[model samples]
Target: MSPLVKKSTGEFEEFDEQKLRRSLKHAGAIPSEIAKIIQQIRPLIHEGISTKRIFNHSFRLLRRYSQECARNYSLKKAIFELGPSGFLFEKYVAEVFKAKGFKVKVGVVKKGCCVKHEVDIIASRPDKTIYVECKFHNHPNRKNDVKTALYINSRFLDLKNNKANEFDEFYLVSNTLFSKDAVKYADCVGVKLLGINSSYGDDIQAIVNKYHLHPITSLQSLKKKHIHALMSREIVLAKSLLKQKKTLFELGLDEMEIKQVFSEIKNVRRSYE
Candidate 1:
């Protein structure tokens, strides 16, 4: 019988190796590396093992096998590092939209029919404009619930009514998943949602991977202070680091540290190629 593994949400279920295998494959691990990782991980599995422990163990092994794969596997956890505040995640989301060819404005205050509201993001293309509300949580199991969707939709309606022609769509995006009630509410109201496992086919993870917009926090080489410093300079994406050699120097990264940062960046870039 499979040992029961505890999830981050405090739920328990029978361990499924196939689920672990799929995640490894998604992280760009080759078949041989995946098998090796599983071989090592299976012995560590025991009753009531936390998913976090399993992840850490797998990540360590994957890092040994390939830096790029480890980085890719760590993407979700890295996003959490974007905050003790949601502001950085908001900026990251803006970058994602910018990569998708939308001209984005973050932290915009627009007057609504009822009152003024500060929007997290306003993404516009030539033909349409989208108002985005970003809900970022540090915990993976934290979900955007029905109340969140209801509030966001109400705000959208106020803005849309006030400037109906200006905004064509509203999107509620998050780094975490949404509850079923949230999804249902959003669907009923015509508000779009983009989060993990989104039915719309454009979840945050998918978009990030699709455009190679991995956040700088995703780099194992960078410390928290280093990440905050880069973000303060508006350098959010890992790809952007390639052109910011001067900024890196200003951040006080010594020769060895800079070399490590650049090396990890190269490996991350190569993962897609």
Candidate 2:
């Protein structure tokens, strides 16, 4: 289809499986990572699913994956399933801070006043620690807004010890284009609001530009590439096995029995790959 005609359809032109896959690939995602993400959203696949819808669906699945697995799994793995964008941004944000010679840890579990919350990215120096919360949502809610404020305010004192520390600062990061009200609320609650492609405090663009971040595309690609590679390698290995000599005696089988082993291996590989 012509580019103009595709645009006229009111659907995003680059929102399908192939496009998403390419985006992910371009963003430097591995195949296995992409495949795991694909598995998470496979049940939702349908004939008419658009690329944009697919991307969004994959993102939601990633969030679900992170939230569910964070408690039990390693922080990096949970974040890996979250998709490239979140993973990458979280990574480089920490990287940028660390690049400046700071101590940084991604996905730190901290005790909040009412709950144990996983802060997206944490940076610490000799004097203080900074808590950063990252968000990429279509909309914001009042309840969530209030809770964020409480999170930051509550950060001043350790929930466990009720002691104040100088190393505390709250940074609320978002990919959604922030609204004036959202900025106001963030200010009212004493949290700094940051938006992708927009200035937050100072040199915000410098950091974004430095990383050249594309979270969704990079993540989807990594997942697909890793899984696809694994599938491909397994296929090659299975094929090689078929060409090799067969051992019938292992199963105490006759001549006909050895062929069954060959067939079974091929079938198993086919099913998995």
Candidate 3:
């Protein structure tokens, strides 16, 4: 069951067990680990926080003594995971915006500091540009969520100051839903929040289910509509590999390697719809 449902007032109501399992799983915690941890902390979690916030609570508790361990096993993975997640999410948002007549550009910035901070998807129509930041965190708080927005906002300001023909709008997206305060902060800063689809949630669950069984990963094997969504990424990687053309054809991409890249391409192409 979904832990969230939109209320008449446009707010989301939280569920208990739904929060516990999803957050725990997102933090890279298995059921056994969560059972032990929750047995101890369940009493202390205040009523204000939902069950989903439990992962954040556990992470904060562990961060004091094992920063690197906590980060590597949980926090850092979630942060880095945002890059690929952003690539997928941007395709959806860009298509939606474009169908509504907005001009959308994907991965266009190729020079200078702008290159260092490429906005995921820029939705524009002559007079305005909208910068986007995508998040795929385990447990993003109001403060944590705002940090990326702040970075993007600062970057946008710098670009604008340099007369860089920038957009006036901004956006933030996440596979994980934001807290009330996170939404408020985004609104206050003129950042629009885009909710992720349930299908993506199912994809994460499938990944987790597969991991628990210690099965081989078939992410590089699945053929999906999102494959073309990877055009720019594949082009960039192919170019880099081409530059090191010592082995070229001799590198001899075996069937598995070819299948893997083909799977990646298929995944991106599916994103167009």
Candidate 4:
């Protein structure tokens, strides 16, 4: 057999269950559970089977052993699933801010010196106001580079006069990691960051866990088509999807899957809560 290719990017590489093993371990699976998952999925590893399939299979099996590990698995794609653009992430961030007691508005356009700029999020409280930029990425490996940091900082600076008035601080939030230079600039220039590799060091999962803002696209009981079907309707959060269980009907999932996924969603919500 030739080398294996990843489903996400079509890059071919050799299979190593050790990587899966390590990921499960890092996600808090014990050694015995880790070995069991690798042993089960190892045979499915061969030429042409996408690593994404392998990963989904591994996560499915891993869930039976450790739900925590399964849920903590890279949540980057869930936010990625939210888009044609970063709209869903922006909405989700707004939801997070709402949960944190900020009055939130998305796609805020304001006059800078020369032109108008749209802020991804504007959240105000009785005490302070903040503006936010959400940097969404599909891949966990894709980091918010320094260029992004500089551009966002400049955008904040241009809006610093705040013609609308408020916003004591500006924050950049991302579903993926951040570059070293991005973090450095943020620290030096005082642009607050809430990214995976942020200087402030907040885990997106931890926020999701705290606020129960689980992404519907991460449901393993639902296949890619099922997730996509929901995403198409702007149903990105698990909390929202499970509320309208009937929406799952049009996604072409059978009754069994519907029931199964509702159960998974309940468990996922419980995990986050």
Quick one: best lDDT, which candidate?
1
- At residue 88, give the lDDT of candidate 3: 41
Model 2 gets an lDDT of 0.48
Off by over 4 Å in 1: 1-72, 197-199
- Please provide, for model 4 over 1-273, each residue's C-alpha lDDT reduced to its tens digit, 9 standing for 90 to 100: 445656566677877666777766756688898888888976777778887788778778887888666566646556677765777788888888887899998897888765678988999999999998988876667888899999988888888865765579989998877888998998899998896423366666677788878787677777887777777786767778667867777667678878898888788667555
Sorting all predicted structures by TM-score, with the top scorer first, yields 1, 4, 2, 3
The 10-residue segment with the lowest total lDDT in model 4: 195-204
Q: Distance (Å) between predicted and true CA of 83, model 1?
A: 0.2
Q: Residues 189-232, candidate 3: write the lDDT tens digits.
A: 66676653222222222322222211111233422322233333
Worst 10 residues of 2 by lDDT: 213-222
What is the lDDT, from 0 to 100, of the residue 208 in candidate 1?
74
Q: Please state every model's RMSD to the true fold in angstroms.
A: 4.1, 16.0, 13.9, 4.9
In model 3, the Cα lDDT at residue 111 comes to 32
- Among these predictions, the greatest TM-score belongs to 1
Residue 196 local lDDT, model 4: 41
Off by over 4 Å in 2: 1-88, 112-115, 138-161, 164-166, 210-273
Off by over 4 Å in 3: 1-85, 110-116, 137-144, 197-273
What is the alpha-carbon lDDT of model 1 when measured against the actual structure?
A: 0.84
Score candidate 4 by lDDT: 0.77
